[model samples]
Structure formats: C-alpha cells, structure tokens
Target: MSTRPHLLYLAWGFPPAAKSCVYRKLATANSFARAGWDVTVVTLTEDAWIREQGVDRSLLALVDPRIRVVRLPLSREDIETDIRRFSEDRALRPRTWLKRHYQQNVSHFPEATFGGWRDELVASVRRVYDERPADLLLTSGVPYTFFAPALDLFERNGLPYVLDYRDAWAIDILRDRPAFRPDSPAGLYEARLISHATEAWFVNGAIRDAYADIYPDRAQDFHVVRNGSDVAIGTDKIPMRQPGPDEPLTFGYLGTVSFSAGLTRAVCEGWRIAREANDVLRRSRLEFRGHMGVGANRGASAQAVAIAEYAKHGVSYGGPVAKADTAAVYEAWDALLLILPGGRYVTSGKVYDYVSTGLPIMSVHEWDHAAAEILSDYPLWVRNDGVEAEDVAEAFLQATKVVQGATVEDRLTARRHAEQYERYAQLRPAVERLTTRFAPGLDHVEPVGDRAPKTGEDVHRETSVPGPHAKGERVVLALTSPPSEAVRRSVALLRESGAHVELIGPDSVLEELRGLADEVITLQRATAPVKVSPSTSVTRFTPRWASVVARNLGRRHIIGPYVRVVGRSAGWWLSARRSPPAMQALKDATVLASLDDSATYLIWNASRLNTRAPARAGIGATLEELGLTRI
Candidate 1:
C-alpha cells in the first residue's frame, strides 16, 4: 500500500447518490484528492439512491479518479421500490407503521431513518480502517447519524478525526433554538459528541454561534465552512439570456429539495398570492428545477403539491437541474428565489449558483438567512422575513420588474457579487484548515479505531433475503385507513424491537382521517377500511401532498402540531420528493399492507391508551420492531 496519508472520507450521499449533498460531498472529496491524499468515500448503494431522489450518474463527473468510491448493499426500507417487495404490513397500515418505524429509528439515534444506519456505518468504517490505515478520518453529516460512526471509531482507538457539521443536528437554526431540551437525551448526546471533536465545520456563522453556546469551552474549534457554489457547476457557457418584450419573465430555483416542507408551502403560497395580487406575476412563469426529493418518493411531494396548487398561475415543476445542467436551469430563468432556512446562519449551496447565474434575485428565505450576507451586495434583490403572502408577492413583483426592466449595468452588478463564492475558493481553505489545524483528543484529540494497515474501497454488505415474502420471515398484520390499527400495532413492534413503547389507550377506537394532519388527531372521514392491494411498494412515487392520503388513516403523530411552520420550513424537502414525515407515515401503512401486513404499528396501538407517545423514551429495544430495520 502507498505510504501517502490516506483520508477515510465518510459522506453518506456521495457523488453517485445524486443527493443534494452530492455537490458538497463531491467538492470536499475532490479537494482532498487534489491535496495529495488517497480518498475512499463510503455511501449507500445505487439501489437505495433509486428509492430517494433517483440517481444521476452524471453528477459524478467532477469526482476525482484517484478517489475510490465504495457502495454498500444497504437500501432504505423507508424508500423501497418495487411494490411487489411491499410487505402485507405496509399495504395495510402505512402511517401508523411508519411512525412506529420512525420512532424506532430515532431510538437508535436522534435522527429518524438514519439512526438505524449507525451499525452499518460503524462496521463499514472499521472495515475501511482495517484494510488501509488512514492517517486522517474526515466525517461530514446532516444525517447526523454519521456522527455515530465517527464516534464509534473514536471510542475504540486513537486516530485523528475532522467533523464537518454541514448543518447542526440538535440545533434548529431556523428557529434559533435548541432542537431538543438541554437535559434531554438528544441534548446530552450532542454535548458528548461535540466534546470529542478535534474541529467542527458549519455552513454559516449563525450555526457556529449555536455550537459555541452548546460547548462554550471548545468555541474556537467550531469553525465556519460556508456552503459555497461550485465553479464548474456555476460557470455558464451561455451567459444571461434576456426575455423578449411581452414574454412573461421566468423565475427559477434549483437545489436539493430536502428538509423543511413548510418552506416549499410558504413559497407556493407566496406564488399563489403574487399571481392573484399582481397581473405581472400572474403572467410570469415560475420554473422550479433541481432534485425534488429523493428515493421512491421523487418528483411528488409537498413541494410538488405547491407546484400543482400554483400551476394555474404559471408555476410549473421541471424536475432535476443537474450539476452539469445548473447553467441551463439558471439560464432559463429571468430571476432567482433564494429560499433558505436559519436566519443569517444558513448559507445554502444554491446561493453560489444563484449569484453566479447573475440573475435578478428574490429572497423567499428567512429575513435573516445567511445568503442575505452574500446577496446584500447584489443591487437587484428583494428579501422578506415575514414569509407572508404579501411579502412573497412583493418579492415576486420586484423580481418581475428586474427581469423586465433591469439595465445591463444591473446584470453586471449581480454577476460581480457572485464572483467570490466559487466552490474552489470555499473548499480549498477548508481542506488546508483541517489538514493543519485538526488533531484528536479531549481537545485537538486523536480519534479511536482499530489500527491496522488498510487501503482501497471497502463497502460491507449485510445479509437480507429479498423476495415476495422475504423468505418466510414472520408475517405481520396490517390494516388500512384509521391509523388506530396501524399505530397501535406499530407500538407493539416498537416495544418488541426495543423501543420503550407504552400503550396509552384502549385496543379499539374510531375517528375520521383528513389531509396533511396538522396535529395527531383521529382519521378524517373514516367511513370504510380499504382492502389490501398488491400494487404498493416502498419505492413508489407518491404525489407531493401525500399527507392528504395519510390523513385518511387515524394515525398522525410523526409531525409536530404546527403544520404551517413545518410546511414553510420544509420547502426543499417537498420539492425533492423526499419522504417527509407528512408523507412517510402514509407510505408506511401503504407498503406494510402490500406486503401482507409485515409491519409493526406503534401510534395506532398507543392510541388505545388514549395518550400521547412518551417523550422521555429514548433508545431502547422498540427500535427493530418499529420498522427502523427497514429505514
């Protein structure tokens, strides 16, 4: 094996996955590769990618050949494809089963769905370390689940590690508050994890502040790693294309639509209001492009729902603006909507592309979003923090005016503002910082992992029989509509799988189920139970507003009571066709039944207790039984 320092890079959504994380992950990987380090990237397999934000191999164009990429055989059971693969459990009770499953996943780790990935990720890292002794272990996360793996190595042996906290896990930057309680298990976990890092990287300064407050002593280690734009992706062969007189202006947004579905809804609502308030907006066409969600739920999500709702007003959904095709998407639009999260703290990767495009920009993000720091220099931009229909409408109005009336001087000014955020400029410094400044210990500490000479791409595959019946695994009971059955059953499984599920209600109850449940209430219009069909699959593409379907079932616990807040915050998630809790709950019950009820329902059973889920229950045995094994 070569003696050059080997960097074991852990990025869950590397190039091949085509996830929004791909651009950052690719940039980070390539930076290391160019820095004279042997890079081995560990990510989920292609099959899993198919189920979430379907893959685009072209995204891998920028990846360095020197970088070795490994794919594990893992598939997110949450976003499974092939309806034939659905267990009877999913087909019968989708929402309840999914909630139970989500809970179980969180039980493994604070992050739902990703929590179960801890073991696989740790094992994979161990194998990678064993095959080639890496001089440094670089870790990046949002699926904060990656932290578990990174920590796993730390606890076991001594090796230097760098933590790229792309987005804070426990801190809700948008709300500018701790995502969970300080004394809560999550809070404690984050505190412990942050305590061990040699260095921490955040996309924006706001995030750094939040971390400093969390770990006052290690404040200096927490560094800023802005989500800058890619020079390769930002460069346009065709420069600014002006709209013809009388041709309605086209406004565009392109990026990974993951996380906050609420953001999408707010933007959509703003789009709807603008069309109604101004003839100019009504006449203009809003073109949204980029990966709209991932997995089997692609192309159809709350974001899609917003597009559909505003389709009448000329807002259309054009799926996936490729990294190579980013220029095309930007070129197609007359203006840009910089929709982001976390006031002033969250500088998204899309901002680099937006400013680089030199298009007139409109800010649909938080009034204090970090991108504002980048765009404040641009003369032709409008920002609104209220997220009110009126503000979005006004932004729409301003963008329309810029697209139709801005002078050459204006366009030149916008382009100039984008010059600074080139991906190269942002990533190179980071590569150097971690290389020179990072070390592992209580402070600048070394990591822990089994030490042995290891090299090459090492992706471990688990043993899971795939087929119609999963090769005779015990058949699970499933029920359609009114999550009472599904939720109740899921609780049983969660308790069985190891979550401390406590039944809070009676065995049976009836209530109406409705669309996009704002709160965990009874099913709206629970007239008749639906029959099981063989056509459901975990990999199926659902509509954007799938919460409407889940509402038909009584189960509605995964999401918070604030639908408007979540909907506005989750715009990216909606567009990406990701399995938002708003939709996943429904999908869970749907898939479980399709597979002959081979699922565990928690919320449904808990409803029998006529009580809410125990917020105190942390990681326990209920995990496996809750379908967490599938996520």
Candidate 2:
C-alpha cells in the first residue's frame, strides 16, 4: 500500500453534473487533494448526468487534475424520457412497468429505485480497498446508500468513514419534518449509519438539530458545515453597478427554478401585481436565468410555463447561465429576486452567491424560512410576509425602492455583511479540522493563495442571529387545510400540557378548528396550484381499471412465461444500457426516501409550527418523542 493517506469520496453529483451540489463536491475533492492527500472521487458516468440533469463540461475544468475521478456505470432508469428506449411492455403500461420494476429493485435494497445498485457499490468499494487501500472514506448523500459500502468497508477492514450530508436523510427539507417513521427502512438505515459513522457533517444547523434530535446518543458526532459560495464567484470579482436613470432596475433570479409550482406561480403573479402597481416595476423586467427543471421537462416545466405565461407582465426567462459567467450576469442586474420553497429547513445553496453579489434581494418564500435567518443581517434584503400576490407585490415595491435609493455605501455594507460567508472561509477551517483529526502526522498544506483573506477564524466567532419570533413564547399551529382527527387529538394533548396554542390557516378552516384551540388566526387563503403537467394529471386521475390492468399484468401467474422471458431480456438490456463502471468502485447506491404520501407535507408544516413553541409537539409521534404529553 502507498505510504500517503488516501481519501475515498463517494459523491453521485460531482463535477460535470451541472447540478447545484457539484459546487460543494468540487470544493470537497479539491480541498482534500490540496491538503496533500490522494483523493479519489467515485461518481456516476458523464452519460448518466447527460441523460438526467445534463452536463456542463466547463465545470470539469475546475476539478483538480491530481485528484482521481472514478465514474460508476449507474444511471436513474426512472428518468429515461426516450420512448424508443422503452420495452414494449413498459411502453404499453408505463406506470405498471415502473411499479413492478421498483418493487423488484427494493426487494434487494431499502431504496425503491436505487436498491439494485447496492451489490455493485459494495463490489466497487472492495476493489478500491484491494488496490489503493483508503485510510479514510467520506460519502455525501442523496443516495444515502453510500453508507452501505462505508459500513461494509469498516466491518471488513476497520476503515473509518465520515458522512458529508449536504441534505437530510430521514428529515424532509421541503416540509421540515421526519420523512419516514422511526421503524421504517430509511429511518433504521439512517440510525445505523449515524451510529457507526466517525463524524457526520450537515450543511446547516436546522439539519444538524434534526439529526441530533433524532439520535440524541449520537448528537456529538454531528458537525455544521455550511454550504458556501464557490471562490470563483467571490465578491471581489463581481463588478458593482448602480442602475442609471434611463436603465430600468433589472431584477434577476439566477438558480434552478425547481421549487414547487405554486411558489413559482406566486413569484410570477407577484411580479405582475407589482408591475401593475408601480411604474418602475412596469418598465423593469424580472429575468429568471437558470435550469428550469430536470430530464425531458428541462426548460418546459410548470415553472417555465408560468414564466412564459407572465412574459407580457415584465417577466422573462433567460435560461441557464454558466458558473464562469455568473459574476457578469449579476453585475448587469441592479437587484435580485430570491424565490425558494419550503420552510425552516430549506436554506438554499444559492443564498451565498446572492449575498456575495451585494445587490438588493426581494424574498419570495415563507416568512420563517432558514434563508430569512441567514439574510437577517444582510442590508439589502426585503421579504414578503406571505405568499399572497399582494404581500409579494409589496415586497417587490419595497425592493425597487431599495435598489433605486441604494448608495455605494449601502452596496459596500452588503458586501461586508456577505464577507463572512465566502466559500473558502466556511470550508477551510472544517477541512483543516477533519484533516488534523484523521491524518494528524501529515504536514499542514499551504492555503490557496489566490482565494480571499484568511478570516475563517473571525467568521467562525460570529454567532447566528435568532429568528424574529425566537423571543415570543407562543405556540403557533399552521395548517394548509382543516385539521384531521389525528391533528385535533394532538392539539388537545398540547392544551392539556399547559401550552398556549394558536391555530393559523385559511379563514374557512380556522373557524371550524377555533373551538378546539385557545385562539385562531386566519391566513386568508391556501396554497394555489400553478399549471398542472400531463403526467401529474394522469397520475392524479388514473382510472381504477388502469391500475387493475397494471397490477394483473405485473403478476407472475397471469403471464408467467412472458414475464420470465421479458425479465431476462430486460435485465440484459438494462445491464447493457448502463454505462461501464470506471475505476471499479460502486456502480449503484440507494435513495433515502420515496416520499409516497401527502402526510410528508402535513408533517413538514406541523414541524415548522412546532419549532416556534417551547414544547415542540405538533405531530403524533413527535409529541411522544419530545415527552410533551400530559403526565
């Protein structure tokens, strides 16, 4: 074995993926390589990304040439949009074919779609161990199945592994609650992974807290490693430009527009409302410049359709801009529109880049979102209190004023505020600490001289500003619709525990739920759906016979001979279709959760509301877990 310490990194979304996660992945690999460690990155083939989110060859230029990249043959079969590639059976009954295929795959592994790749992943790890013999393993998750190999390697060779969780496993980011039941396969796997992991890294505190709360015994293992902007898009590189009198104050949104359709529509509607009300907004355009969606629907998703519909109302879609051109794009814009989905757990990776731009940002998300927490001290931020058109319209108007009146001093202050979150500043200290812990005897690597000032220690000292309602000792229960019997039972339990409970939702439901609670507040409306896609419509309103036919066709007894023949043929076809595994690591890993139920959304909303209260009990098991029940 080589004397040098070898770090094996398992990240599915590495460079060339062009996905948001690539920035962090690239930084991670480069950091390890720069630290004098032999870094090997295991990720899916380029063709896999090309088939799914598409690739950005320009991003590959950023990768440290010294670091070894192992591309696995894995690809998401579910996202294959080409009709010609589908089997006759799948072509005829796509939904049924998918269901059966998923069922078969999940039988082998816990993850529905990704379970089949477990064996390949394990084999790859074994091969890498036999050759290079890694001293340490670091796995980033979406396909948390990387833990399976990490566990395998540890059990077999006693090699330690660290989990770089960019996003949560059991905890749902969108809804801000437990994604799976504690006893479920995903939850059990997560518990096992965390229990064995030497250390667990989270992108933010909310995620860290969620994991810590779930596994109190393993709480000490979790570390906060905030996702910072790329050094390439540093504040220094971005040219600050004030809008001239003749030039309209252009508001730009530069990131993937993959949030919920409702959120996207709300932003468009808000822009229209603002434009109608303000002459400045009417003259000024709101340009959305990024990947609209993934797979076949890229640039034609519900979000893109909404943007197209609102094109007449000063909203324009500029498609995706390259990472290299991000600074130039930001410089052209006078202000930015920060539109995101979800509640407290959803701190967007784009926020760092937006902050670094030093431009006035109009927020179009929930008031209690984690982005709001990060941008609280940011000077040029104007947030919409609600998702309603009028609320967002007012925010747009406010942002317009901020942009028009923004002095050079104001811009400078914004840049100064953002200085703390520079990519290297956030990453270097954490990387150094991990390196010291794992490879103590190794000499400390010199800093990347071209990067920003070494103020990571200073930035680390600054504590996060508490939320607006952090001081308020009141329990707020927010619901999308009327409370179910289970929700009512939970509410009664909360009251019995001496908690001051206030219910907030639409006026129609608030009155009905009022008698069950101490006080009621109306939110005026529920979330409205944007344009529905054909696939969604079909899935939502599929005929009973169609399911019956699908189920029947999928059974072995109904068409045993045909199934046997097709299964063998399909297996061969799928194997051939999958790209060859590069560098002989893992070819497949498992996804954490499938999100099959509406209950996930409900639990998320309840979880967000629970965060405001001292007791922190909104859901059924959550109440019991927190021991908030009346004795």
Predicted candidate 1 versus true structure: per-residue lDDT over 374-450, tens digit per residue: 88887777767577677777778667767777776677667777767766567766677666653221122122111
Each candidate's root-mean-square deviation in Å?
15.9, 19.8
Model 1's TM-score against the true structure: 0.68
Q: Judging by lDDT against the true structure, name the best candidate.
A: 2
Model 2, which residues run further than 4 Å from truth?
A: 449-631
Model 2 TM-score is 0.71
Tens digit of lDDT per residue, candidate 2, span 447-479?
754364433221212122222121212444444
Backbone collisions counted per model? 125, 3
lDDT of 2 at 357: 72
Error of 2 at 618 (Å): 41
Pull out the clashing pairs in model 2: 121-586, 124-585, 175-604
